[model samples]
Target chain A: MNEREFLKQYDKTAFDQPIFSVDNVVFTVANGGLEVLLVQRAEHPFKGHWGLPGGFVDLQKDLTLDDTALRKIREKAGVEPDYIEQLETLGSSQRDPRDWSITTVFTALISKQRCVPTDENVSSANWFPVTTLSELQLAFDHLEIIERALKRLKNRATYSLVPCALLGETFTLAELQHVHELILGKKLEAKAFRRRVENSEQFEETGGMTSGRGRPAAYYRLRPGAMGFEFVRSV
Target chain B: MNEREFLKQYDKTAFDQPIFSVDNVVFTVANGGLEVLLVQRAEHPFKGHWGLPGGFVDLQKDLTLDDTALRKIREKAGVEPDYIEQLETLGSSQRDPRDWSITTVFTALISKQRCVPTDENVSSANWFPVTTLSELQLAFDHLEIIERALKRLKNRATYSLVPCALLGETFTLAELQHVHELILGKKLEAKAFRRRVENSEQFEETGGMTSGRGRPAAYYRLRPGAMGFEFVRSV
Candidate 1:
């Protein structure tokens, strides 16, 4: 048969297919630590347990896996993330109780200031400190997924300005350094951090200043249309 | 219902599911350029068209996406790769002719010396220079998938010992530099490159010497049990 005829005769339902879903690990810097947004599942398998915001891909609505991730983030988190990236895809016959399943996990960074506390679809939504993940029960392999994403985010913070997505539109150098420190789980020398940021040329003065600090520090914002820059050395 | 009862009643066949598959872009340094392995499809969908080695994830045989990728590589290329990494997952309604399909792409690096050329499962298999990709007609979105994999491999080579996977068990420093140059598409200064490699401490002297070419060069092998190390500065 020709190509067109072959497609017409193809029957996808002849074989067993894995249940495919997209999950988002939305992170923000809050309460002096990195926090991940999670929603209490409203349906079976893991209902009432906290899980990453996600669901089955709507074949009619999603053009790509990314579209599924983005749509889920909006529907469950009620906010637009400042940055998002595909973390990894995990699959197995054991991860889900329903059947063989596969999920593509996405990592998103959003400023906590932009998020609404909860969405109507989920039983409840909350931002929980990543440090406390061990004490809580989560659905599927979500805890493992979040830990992996956290490791990636930490490594990324060392060479790129990715953690800036956790902050507001404008901030002082001290605030920026704090976000980096939180993600890196360590302190950075103030002088060295300033030099690295200046060399990267990824930010611009916002002509604003912090009001409550000991010394009024100037505010800066990421340059218009400027993407994250990779630094030669860790800050 | 309880978890066990819920799983027993859940029917995966009730809902329409997207076809899930894994594709691998296996790369190696050969003929003084970067090359990717492609296999001619023996099945009807894109029969006889050159494509990245890939196929449907067998529910009975594959436990994870990586397993599917590795199985396809072995079946289509007849070689064990030195390194393999997941690139990204791509899904859409229009890309596949049979159905809405989702594919997780993987990038692998292998030494050309080990490959057996053609495998029994494919019509034909060969390594094609990445620079000539535009001239060849590829099946599905395989061309776009290969390009994306190529870009990721190049970026990885900049700050990690990833490109070494494209060499035999032992290779001279000069040979390693040549492989990096082919991937980066630019010449690196000899002195700077050597310094970077030495500082990374990722290789050990194999106590061998090259037999051909202008001066005999000392050979090196990746340190035993050593994973790829990220450099503080790009080489």
Candidate 2:
């Protein structure tokens, strides 16, 4: 049928409604492994269970999904993060109990920062290592969300120095390598890693030095506007 | 606030409702360039305008986002695609004039196959080259979605053998290179590209030969269940 024929049969309101929400997986490096920030639910649906910090998006106020993510982080964690990326969208009719909904998952990075729940629906906010996340049951499909975020982080770490977001403003080369090792789950050759970093041209010297014992390593920071490195793998 | 205290102040119904939808960017390689499948709208908002082939999710019956995508393609187009990946979600309050809405975008690749609109809301379904997408005024924010999908395809081609989806079931190494060149928008080195393809270990010989005038190239196909390649760049 032509455009006119199709127009006559089209119904404008033939669509179902669904609630849209945002969930955040805030990751930070602490102790010796990667940790994710989670909040305890206080509602009847798996009440008192652990889950990623999240909330329903206010369509009247939030302009974009990114805005909703930032707002939810602030409302739940009480701090701004350094890096945030849209990880994936988990949508299904049975994922949420109250209504059919879709949740756009986001992955954020912070440097061992504290997150305190500003909302009453959440009982507690704390960081848990990725290795131990499987032991505890998370509300909703949060466990799957965290797993996807970790996989994305690992893939991104190959071409980009994104794991540096887990460290302070300035860090030593050894500290940087450790972050990479923790995220990649493998020990990298120190010499090859240094060479790849220098070739990427994404970092600059901070004109400072580490004051700890042993040989003082130079403090280097991500360049002003570096997006990612050129190397795929170094070790 | 404690979890108990937070739960007291939380209102489950305190959220603004928005319309949720899905849009697909179906791409294929034909006539020496990349093409995208589009449909002419027959509704009032953008009657007679071109847009990505898509529709709203049915919360009443649809189970998952992936299912919705598959159904939309089967309903809008007549055939199923070989590859589909979540591109990105385009969300905003002002994007839709009739109502506030958010649409999750998906990118799909198929061999040069035909697609016909099964719904009347779409007058015509046709494929347009990516290079000439700007010449046509697409409805809503589809232009942005197509641009993003093209960029994603280029990046994904660097790491994965996704471009092979655009070719037929059996193809020579040279035909495969041509597909990569079209997607990457650049010519690649033959010797290095071959070495990289061999190292990826994602292809196997079919023991068939191309029946052409000149030297017959050996027909090769993607190894059964080959996900992605390891080569980043060889040119």
Candidate 3:
């Protein structure tokens, strides 16, 4: 038979399918620490437990997996992320209680000031410190998902300007370093960090200054059209 | 209802599901170039067309996505990979003709010497040079998937011992550099490359030497229990 004829006679329901879904681990630097946005599940199969913002893919609405992930982030967290990328895909028969399931995970970075968590389609949405995540009772395998996202974020911060997404529109180098330190959970050598950032040429002086305890620090912002710049060396 | 009771009554078939499958972009350094493994489809819709080795996920036989990918690699390529990692997940309505489909892509690296391609469930299995991938009429968005995997492999080669997987059990530093150059498509500075490799401390002298052109090059192999080592700087 020809290709078209074969497709026409294909039976898609001949085999069992897994539950496919998208989940977003939205992150921000707030309250002197890294925080993740999570929603309290209002439905069964881990009701009332905090989980990453996610749901089943809507075949009619989502044209791609990214659309499903962004839709979940906006609907559950009430915030549009500044930076997002696919972290990893996790699947198994034991992860979810419903059935064999697979979830494409996305890691998103946004400023906490821009997020206004809404209680729509969920019990509540809130930001919790990543350091204390082990103390909370989370839904499904979300704790492991968050930990994986955190590891990726920390690794990227070592050699890329990924943590800058958590800062405001304009900020000093000191502020940028602080955000990186929060994500990495360690302090970087100041001179080496500045050298790496300056060498990347991804940032520019905004001709402004911040009046802090030390000498007024010059403000800077990402160079126009610059995004996801990586350094040749880690700081 | 409680968690167990809720799962018992959950209707898994309520929503239309997408066809889920796993594909492997197996890479090897052979014939002095980077090559990818391709299998000719034996069944319709795109029968007779060359595509990445893949098939629909068998829910009963496969316990995880990685298992599905490995099973496809073994069945179609007839080789076990030395290194494997998830490249990305691609899904859409237009990619598949039968129904909405999603595929998790994996990037695998193995030496050409170890692979013995067999046509068990496929019409034929062979290796094609990556440089000529554009000329071939591939099936089911596989060309794009392969390109994405190639980009990732190239990126990882710059700062990690990733391309070493394409080498045999033991090789010389010169042989390792040749593999990296093939993947990166550029000649690396000898001193810088040696510095990065030595600094990572992932390889150890195998006490063997290759008697080639000028001098006898010492052979080396990965340190015991050493894997996925990343450098702090790009070579």
Candidate 4:
């Protein structure tokens, strides 16, 4: 049926009424370490509760999903990002206190030193060590959300030097491995880990900055004169 | 100010709508096969579209988020899931063709072959070879949703032989490998893959049904003796 015929038959009474919204899982790298960005609640439900950065979706907002998440993170925390990814969606009923809402989770990474709690609603926005974030009373089912996001990054790290997004612009392989260990929750054999990373060749020797303290370490950046080392298909 | 005073000041006109709901991402292994179930669309605006099984969240129903997703999948496709997991939410404004919708992507796996398509609306419901699933034109952003689901399954497979849910009460090592290969989307070096599989320690020999063209593949079942895994942490 055409529009006119469809409307004539249409009940125009009621149909599916789902509350759509977005929630963010911003993960940033700073201080030679990996961490996640979290905001302290300022209102009820879980007032004084700690959670990932998120809010209701405003249909009127002129922004894409990714844009909205990044904007909210920056506005709420006063930090800009160098890397961001759409993690997953959370839509369990009772995930919220007052309504049945679905949340889209996104992840963002930036220099840890760059974030400062700027918004009034955020009583606190701090970077918690990735090794320890799992032990807190996470507001909502956010603990699970964080779990999935962390796992994705860990898998990504095996084929790509993604933890670099959680690292300084220039750093050592040892420093990078520390991030893999922390995120994967296991100690990777150093020799094998180094071999896999170097063989991929997504990094170029900067021949610039040296590792801080004691022995000097090689500096590298997004590889030049090299392809992206191919996105490895899952195996 | 308690309920009385708050109610007097509250703008009832600004807030008037029933709550929406979220589904889940479920994964399981049976007969040593890794497959995802889907439903044929029933309503208009992509009516008859092949998609994941889900529906509106009926908050008035005495069900939680988990229950809501379970009901939708079972009702829509007659799938009695052994395991159902919440993968993520897809809340894009344009996701639904006919109405404003916020969908929760839930991934599940069933062990029995009898759970095949039975619903009136579903033209067919069957498991896809996870390796070739990405090539199909899934409705909405479900294509991306499945990708995330498969990624979750692959990572989980390394530590937890969750794929056992796709296999039968007894199965061979080759069946297990096939399931993993299908989900991971690449052929595995049998020797290397077997080493990893045996190392996870979640499988047990059945001393039961074993069959093969050449060598008899050993039958194994879930080490029901093992305890459930804890929530994995994220990025």
By DockQ, the best candidate is 3
TM-score of 4: 0.70
> With candidate 4 superimposed using the best TM-score fit, by how many Å does residue B212's alpha carbon deviate from the native?
12
| Fnat for the candidates in order | 0.71, 0.53, 0.78, 0.26
Model 2, global lDDT: 0.81
Each candidate's root-mean-square deviation in Å?
A: 1.9, 4.7, 2.3, 6.2
What are the per-residue Cα lDDT tens digits for candidate 3 across B81-144?
9999999999888898888789999999989898876655644888999999998889989998
Q: Which CAPRI tier for candidate 3?
A: medium
Query: What are the per-model DockQ values?
Result: 0.71, 0.39, 0.72, 0.22
Residues forming the 10-long window of minimal summed lDDT in candidate 2 chain B: B114-123
Q: After superposition, how far is residue B22 of candidate 2 from its true place, in Å?
A: 0.8
> Model 1: per-residue lDDT, tens digit, A105-212?
999999989887455664478889999988889999999999999999998999898889899999889999999999999999999999999988889998988788
Q: What is the TM-score of each candidate against the true structure?
A: 0.95, 0.89, 0.93, 0.70
Quantify all predictions' global Cα lDDT against the true fold: 0.88, 0.81, 0.88, 0.64
lDDT tens digits, residue span A37-70, model 3: 8888889988989999988777899888888888
lDDT of 2 at B146: 91
CA deviation > 4 Å runs, candidate 2 = A1-14, A113-123, A227-235, B1-14, B114-123, B232-235
Q: Is candidate 1 or candidate 2 better by DockQ?
A: 1
Q: How do the residues B1-235 of candidate 4 rate in per-residue lDDT, one tens digit apiece?
A: 5445554564422533322445444444444545566655555545556566666667576345677878877775577676667665544446654333456667777665646667665456555655566667676666677778878877765556665566666778787777767666667678776676576666788887655567666788777755344223210
lDDT (10s digit) by residue, model 2, range B75-94: 76677888898988878877
Judged by TM-score relative to the true structure, which candidate is superior, 1 or 4? 1
What's the lDDT for residue A227 in model 4? 28
lDDT of 4 by residue, A72-182 (tens): 777667766767777766554567654555667777666565566776655577777766876777788888888788788777766665666666666677777787776
Task: Give a tens-digit lDDT track for model 1, residues B1-235.
Answer: 8877877888887777888888999998888899999988878777888888888778899888788889888887787799998999999988988888899999999898988746567448888999998998899999999989988988988989999999999998998999999999999999999999999888999888888768888999999876577876887
- Candidate 1 lDDT for residue B68: 88
What is the TM-score ranking, best to worst?
1, 3, 2, 4
